[model samples]
Target chain A: MGNENRIVNGLLKLHIALCLLFIFAPIAGSFVFSLNSDRFPSLPLGEFSTEWYRLIWEDPLVWQGFANTVVVGLTVAVIATLLGFGGAYTDFRYNFTGKSFYLALAMLPPTIPVVIMGLAMLAFLSRVNLSGTTISVIIAHGVMCSPFAMAIIRLRLSQMDPDLEAASWNMGGNQWQTLRYVIIPFAKPAIFAALFITMAVSFDEFAVAWFVSGLNETLPVKILGFLQGQVSPRINAIGSLAFLSSMTLIILAQLLLRSPEDKKS
Target chain B: MKVNAEMEQQSEAIVKFDNVVKRFGNFTAVEKADFEIGRGEFLAIMGSSGCGKTTTLRMLAGLEDPTEGAIYLDGEKVNGKATWDRDTPMVWQSLALFPFLTVQENVEFALKMRGVGKEERRQRAEKWLEKMQITEFANRNINQLSGGQKQRVALARALVTEPKILLLDEPLSALDAHLKVRMQAVLSNLQKDLGITFVYVTHSMSEAFSMADRVVIMSRGQIEQIGTPEEIYREPYNRFVAEFLGSANIFDSVITGPSGSDGWKVDFEGGETSLSKDELPNAVQGQAVTFIVSAENMQLSAPDSGQPGILASVAGEEFIGGTAMVFLETETGHELKVQKSHDELSLLNLHAGSKVIVHWAPESCHILPGENL
Candidate 1:
């Protein structure tokens, strides 16, 4: 039994190590390429250079794409968090007919194959003449990010002591006051988590952005365009930046979610 | 005392439920509740779970709106009004203390919402905390306090607003037995000192009996009986009330014939018992009625003593310190319970399977009309 347990433990560790290597290998390669002094990222101790970073920083399209991505991502984050919180609150707080069906419908966006969703969104946008706009990217990303936001908010709402809201109301506070003071305050970490996670998702989102962004290319769309055209160490530099920022935002979300909600004495 | 009585005579009902009915979707939560809460009364609505006891209190607190009728607060109709506008506060069983707020902030939440200045809210909360004997924990968060302390904080928070009526939804039900008893005394004393109307909802009969001035017993969304605790304990209006209030030994007794001008002879199993007809004014001959006697009222005896009582043998015994509940199986196999004090039970030494007779005075029985057993 002891020998078998040791073998299992060794195997588990090896599996986890292999998974981590698989995930980080691309990011490590991207980072190395981003710093290579040569054009192609040739090996044999290539001298490190900040030239690609300087070029990307100097490029107008890169700056424009970066700003566009931030704007769209923040907008999506706000809409997704608010809509998600409202949907979760209504779904959890009251009973109504068709609740299950409505919930299932709301959650169908992400599972419907992103390419199909992008194509459908693109078709809708073009028909409405709203294609290629920043709002279009924001709209597409908002639809995709909301279900995830609702899921996290719903999880937090479920863990919440529901009477806290009731108590606030019972204490002669109106619905808005209770929501402001009690429900929202208690759900702060979850809301923050949702915000950061959704923003990261919006920033990293590409296929829908590619279809709808047109001339308003988000960072990911710009990177895709660069790869399709003539990829350089500069594209690697952009990938590395994407990897760093998304990881940072996700880690911030995890920190917020894991923050001690129950205050110590 | 005389002046206080004269003033009390002029006091009106603080909260009134006028033909209120609350329904969620198609299921009714509070059905046809029409009761007036006196200006300074501690009224407890007691029932088993799903009896709408808490729902009734929620209606008064404005947490639930009546689907049919109106609720009045201080003589003003408040139908379809939100809970916050009702001016009635609640101390929930969960305490519902904000995990993010300190004890002071929790106690001052209503005041803050009412737009009270910070200094004034702090002073008022401090005063309430002092009154509740939780002054030391004013700055501490809810998680830091023990169960009793948290309950005190909840009480303080509820009282800080000085609302004329306070609704408590089984606030002490979450506490341990000993803490519950202590909190019961604390709640009663606080209610008395403040002279505020309290509508307490609880499922524990003893808790309701010990603290409430009037106990309203509910069953299946309907008010079964509403009366003072003494009246309820001694004179339950129906079988449901009798059985729900206490450990009652109820048997199916049939009205056989008239014993006298106001009495009827009842036959149960193969035995004859006479009950006062005055107590059963509408009892008809050949009609089935439930015979009820509280476990405390019935006495146990040795079967060989030749007593004129129901013949039975002890089936089980449960002793709770000073009192013992003796369960007896009659010859007809109907189970009857007899409660006796420790000293009284000691002489009989009735263990399991002991032969005995269950005896109670005919007047001690509370008879309720029955359709079926």
Candidate 2:
């Protein structure tokens, strides 16, 4: 039995190693490829060069795409976080008719196909004369990102004790004051997490942005257009850079919103 | 009982509940609760779970508003006033400290909300934390503190506001027994030192009896009785209050004879006794009543004593904490619990299945007028 247990432990260690390689191999490979002088994918490392990154940066179209991504990402992050927080607070604190229905509606956007949601929004916006505009793309991205924020914020709110809010009210804090001092501070971490995810989703969005972005070009759309015409070391460099930036933001967001429970020890 | 002019002129009770009714659909949480909390008085509302005691505290805290009637704070009608405007602070059961903030920050938030300057808030927070004996933890996160330490921080946080009244909802229920006793003393002294009116809610009889000047016993959304601890324990108004307070040997009785000046001669199946003054005072002749006698007041004797009172046979005996619980079965097959002090145990020397007589003085029998025997 002891020998069998040792064999199981050995297999478990091997399995973990394989899993780590499977996860990190692609990211490491991309980082290495972005520096390779060759434009084609190859295993042998070539002379490291930033020429690809420099070329991508100097491209006017690429810069325009980057600017579009920033605007769309920020707008979606702010709008989605606000909507998500409001939905979570309402679901947690009060009981009303059709509350479950409202919660399901809040979750519907992220669960449905992005193409379908984009098409529905495109149809609605066309009727309202809002199609083919930057505002339309921002709103569409916000819609797609909101459900993610709402789910995260709701989980955080549910874990918190309801009595905390009541305690604030009893301590002579009005409704707004309790929300400001108690609920907001306790939810800051989840709020930051929601913002990070929302920004990432809007920045990397393709399916929905391709439909409604008439004159506007988000980086993902612009990148797809460039890929259709050619493949290069520059594309790989931009992909590597985008992947790193998203990872850094997510890590920083999680740190900023660290749970006090984790630090008690 | 002496009333000073200033106190009398401060006719405004710190907290008052006047015919307030709160209902969650068909179930009534608090049914027309009429209560008044005096300034500087420590009052406890106690009951079993689902008895609406916590609901009553919530209504007073303005966390939950009553469906009917009004609440007043310091003579002003505050039924519609926000909790912050009422100036009543609550110490929550879970402590509910802001886990992300330092202990000092949690305590100072109230003062900051009231627009106190940062420097003054810091000084006040430190002083309160010192009084709570948790000054060392002022810079530590609340999650880092022990249960008792967190409790003290919660108290400091609530008290720093220095409101006219404070509401505590089972503040010490989560502490270990030793810590509970220690914090009870601290809280009792704190209330006395600060002169703040305390409206506490708890289910522990010892917690209520040890700290409260007055207690309101609730059952099923209605106030069963409200009195001092001694009065509620010794002279409970009904069988519920009597049994809720402590152990009692209730005898099924009836007023078979004529009424006396104080009460009447209540006759049980295997006993006859005169009722005390507080119970069944208006009992008419031949009126049915149930007499309740405390276990400590009962005397167990050998059957041959011929005391011309209740007679029973010893059912069993068990040595409980600091007391001998003698169980006796009366002639009608009713069991009675008699508590004998350790000093008195040597005199009785009780044994199970032995014949004995269970008797009490006429004054010890409280005859309650009720249908359920």
Candidate 3:
């Protein structure tokens, strides 16, 4: 029995160590690279300093790109959530014609090649003379993020009891009233979850933004631009900061929207 | 209480279903059901599952629309109106309270939507919480309460709106047996004191019979019978109604002999019974028929002067609460149940395999012709 327990404990500790390494390896490597004075990322030894972090902050083009990314992420989150919510509500509540076809169409974004969607949008937008601006980038990001939002929110909506809405209606609530009072409140957690995930997707998206963004330079594209040179440690600083921002935002959103029982004591 | 009682009495019929028929694509749920509930009447729709009893209640509550009929509340046709417009509230089987909301907020939600003052809503909510014996749970989240406490909170929420009608869809079916009995009494007394129109749906006959002013029994999307509980139990219209309510002994027979102006002699299973034509209207000579007799009305041993009756052998004996059931197998291999008081059990001393003479008067048997039987 002692031998068995030792083996079991060893396996559990090994699994936890592997999990932590898998999560933090990339982050720690990027941080180390950002501080290394050696311009080449492959170099083993160099004088450590905060000069790269200062350079990242001083770059006006990087700040512009960061601002553009934030704006695009927020815009995409709102648009994708609205479209996904409409589609989910239609599929769940009503028996409209072509419901299955619409649902299938809604699922195309996550499965299709991002480059292909980006190329298709580019061709479509160029013909309409709307390529490369904030509108085009916003539309492309919204389309790319909607399927993920729909998937998350639909999961939450499906778990809800339909009778609760019926009870609201029986209590003298109209369709709008029932939606506002019962359905929306029950779906708030799902909406927040979808929002955070969509923001992450839009903020980190590169391939599609590379094609659709003409004049608008999001942070990811700017980082890609920096990679054309001799491995700038300033780019490493930017990557580390972006990773930290995403982790904090996601954890905060999850904490805010957790079920009542999971809230703090 | 007196002022509220007078107001309820003066209120008109709260809900009326006029031949409502609800069908799903090819299947019918409620087939032309008709009923009216007066104000402040605690009516129960009772049947086994899939009997359209719940569908009927849903129609009245406006949770569902009838495919082939109209519903009226306060003399207004509300067939197309949404549930919220009907001014009726529902207590669900799952107690569909907002889990995130405090008990007070959940109960006051409808009032808030109606634009009632915040202070007034809280005050009225406190009143309903007290009435439902849940005042201490007023500020707690719904998930924090126990099952019975949650049920009371849900009831308080539904009643706090003071809607013209309150619909309950199997609200107590999920409770444990002990809690069910307790809540049943609580609901019964609460409805009486509040004097609000209650349209309750349930599959349990005991639950329906205990509190309903009138019970509607449904079977296969049709109303089987509608009457007071006593009338329904005492005089069931057909075999389905009789069997669904509880127990009844059904016997197949064919009329044989007849009397001049008095009664006829019916032969059944090697025994002839002298039953008046008035007692057996469809008992034509040489015609098939069935007779129904309640178990409690059956006598174990006949008096020496009574008519000759069928002999039944005790197949099984069971002692119930304050009564005993003697399962009797007739000579023709049919089972007939006879219920007797505990004191009467000592006289009969019934056991399995015991031969007992089962007897009943002509008036006790409800005779049905073969076709209707």
RMSD of 3: 4.2
- Could you give the DockQ of candidate 3? 0.62
Q: Give a tens-digit lDDT track for model 3, residues A45-133.
A: 59988889999899998999999999999989988988888878877798778888989999888788988988999999888988989
Compose the digit string of candidate 1's lDDT tens values, residues B1-373: 9878645544677777878888888898778998888898999999999999988888778777779988778767888788877778898988899999999999999998788999999999999999999999988878888999999899899989888888898888778999988888998898899998999999999899999999999998999889999988777878788778658877777889999777899987747788997767877899887778888989777778788988888888887778988888887778888888988877877777878777888888777543332
When sorted by lDDT, best at the front, the candidate numbers are: 1, 2, 3
Q: Looking at candidate 2, what is the lDDT of residue B327?
A: 80
Give the alpha carbon lDDT tens digit for every residue of B1-373 in model 3. 9978645634656666788889989999999887778888889999889988888877777778899888878767888787766677889988888865788989998887677899999999999999888898887877788899999888888888787678899999989999999999998998888888788899988899998999988999998888899988877877788778657776666777786677776667746566568756655788766667889988777334354567778898788899988888888887888899888877867677877788877678776432344
Candidate no. 3 TM-score: 0.91
lDDT of 2 at A50: 90
TM-score of 2: 0.91
For each candidate, what's the DockQ? 0.74, 0.66, 0.62
TM-score of chain B of each: 0.92, 0.92, 0.89
| lDDT (tens digit, per residue) of candidate 2 on B1-373 | 3557535635746777889999998999999899888889999999999999999998887778899999877877778777776677888988888876899999998887788999999999999999999999888987778999999899899989778788899999888999999999998998999988999999999999999999999999999888899988876778788778768876777777654666567677777887754545455777677768899998867678776656777787788889888888877888888898877866756666777777788878765443433
**What lDDT score belongs to each candidate, Candidate 1 first?**
0.87, 0.84, 0.82
Q: In model 1, state the lDDT of residue A43.
A: 72
> Judged by lDDT, which candidate is best?
1
Write the number of the candidate with greater lDDT, choosing between 2 and 3: 2
